[model samples]
Target: MESSAQLVIFAGLAIGLIYGAVGLLSGFCLMSSMRGWLAEGDGRLVRTYALAVAVAIAASQILAGGGTVDLGKSIYLQPTFSAPVLFLGGLLFGYGMVLSNGCGSRALVLLGRGNLRSFVVVIVLGIAAQMTLKGLIAPARIALVQVSQATANSNSLPSLLATLGLGETVSRTLAAAAIVVALMLFAFAHAGFRRSPGQIAAGIIVGLLVAGGWFVTGYLGADDFNPVPVTSLTFIAPIADALQYAMLSTGLTPNFGIATVAGVFAGSLTTALASGRFKLEGYSSPRHMLRSGSGAALMGIGGVMAFGCSIGQGLTGLSTLALASFVAVAGILLGTAAGLRGALRVQPLAVA
Candidate 1:
């Protein structure tokens, strides 16, 4: 209805388009990256992910520092959060990712490429996420959060530093710089990774997309009459919301998330067609379908509890340097490790 909201939606579309194209071309999925690095002994993809995180932090903090956006308004910076719930959610989501062989965003990309199995995953995940967010599971999720939640005066790392005598700007800059430097080092340490320009570009573009989403909602969409929600690129809630909006278009107005989700699908489809890579694919067996469906359910439920998916918490949430984000991410990493290694590891499915 509002002009600014329209602008935000259009901006979201553009960001999603770029992200879809880049993701399709670069194979940028956290599960794939982790599998490559840990399971396959290839570190280039993981390094690309690390670089993206580093760049996202740098770019997002710059926007905040310039007063272009209020990071405080984002969900990651809430004054009260349940660390235990978030961590558990992250674990569930991570393990689900491994079971499903990818996360929500990855499933979207695959769907764009005509993967019918991803279609199943997307549908199941959306329904499950919606259930967790506002349907039957909402009560349990709410009860758990209420029981485990904790409140704090400083909800973010920079804000925490601010209370320790540093100026607001200084604290933000210091924290961002320290984290960025460490991530960059990890991203660039490998010679193979350093030599790959395509992966490098993918990281940079994806990171900028995260910041771009923030700018679209926080700055461009800021209106005195009807302000858009201050958010960045994340997949879990958006996927559920998208599915709802698709069915209830007569009553619901599209938001940035829904538009972005559509854009990702469209963008990926265009890319796949153009690249001659589109192919219809399906599950190899009934067991594969069962595993995939189960995994999607976990992702939907866990993502809701954690307040984000892998790309959501791993990149966008981390950009805010929120303490809860760190806890969630740690849980995600641990969960992924469990799935990728040890006796609990998910074994590869045999082709039917």
Candidate 2:
């Protein structure tokens, strides 16, 4: 038990450290990438995001193919997928992330750099996620899940392709390769993106971290006596878990998510301090606080509903080629666009 726990902790922290360092350096926010593309007509960052996703899928699939990881055991590959939860949750999370000026993962990084406003966002997001997960909203959320859930032949595209008559290995290989190649071509086609090596490295590192996350949890962390849930980078539930662990650690054992959450903060803080970027920051007005708080709440609730946040469904879950992840990512993009231009825009800076 102790050895397994130690290994899980070590694994989680290693991956988390890489995530924090690379994420901070790269400014890897899916919401920001979407905004850059839609609002600013800039595709460079978006391409970076694509590269990360592409690399993650290829690397993870390779692991699965070689039997280094059991991708099916992950929650993203469940037989039944909650379409409503993913779509609506992704929508809310997208808009809320925009409103907060960052996603949940970004908030953690910012908080590490002494952004008190991010602290508020993190606290609200954590509490709201807990509420949606198991607090006051759980009943309603579960009811929604029960009604909206649909059982699929398989949630993964490769599996679906296999079922449609292709050889299983061929189906998986072809699908994964196609997506990977397409995304890579798209990412590299941008001349500006091609010129930015730092950004490219960032994308690759982030993607490998996702694959590393799978390897750590699925293989190294897997144990019959003290099993850990196989998962990768995600912020919603883990934020809540971190909060709960801080309060009730005596009664609860720290898990991968919680450890990852803490490592992100620690890693970011260290990097920020070393880079001389640490500075105290807070809301400028009461209105700013209210706006940020509302956005945080929305992110928490929406992330749980969707079963993951931007990075969760966007990079990690999508890496699995899960159908629900596709829908959820689409919803996130749509919602982000809506928030950027439509009447639903949560523009506290401009609107307030």
Which candidate wins on TM-score? 1
* Whole-model lDDT values for every prediction: 0.94, 0.88
**Residues 120-213, candidate 1, lDDT per residue (tens digit)?**
8999999999999999999999999999998988888999999989999999999999999999999999999999999999999999999999
lDDT score of residue 240 within candidate 2? 98
Q: TM-score for every candidate vs. truth?
A: 0.99, 0.97
Best by lDDT: 1
Clashes within 3 Å, all models in order:
0, 0
Where is model 2 more than 4 Å wrong at Cα? 348-352
Clashing pairs in 2: none
Judged by whole-model lDDT over C-alpha atoms, candidate 2 comes out at 0.88
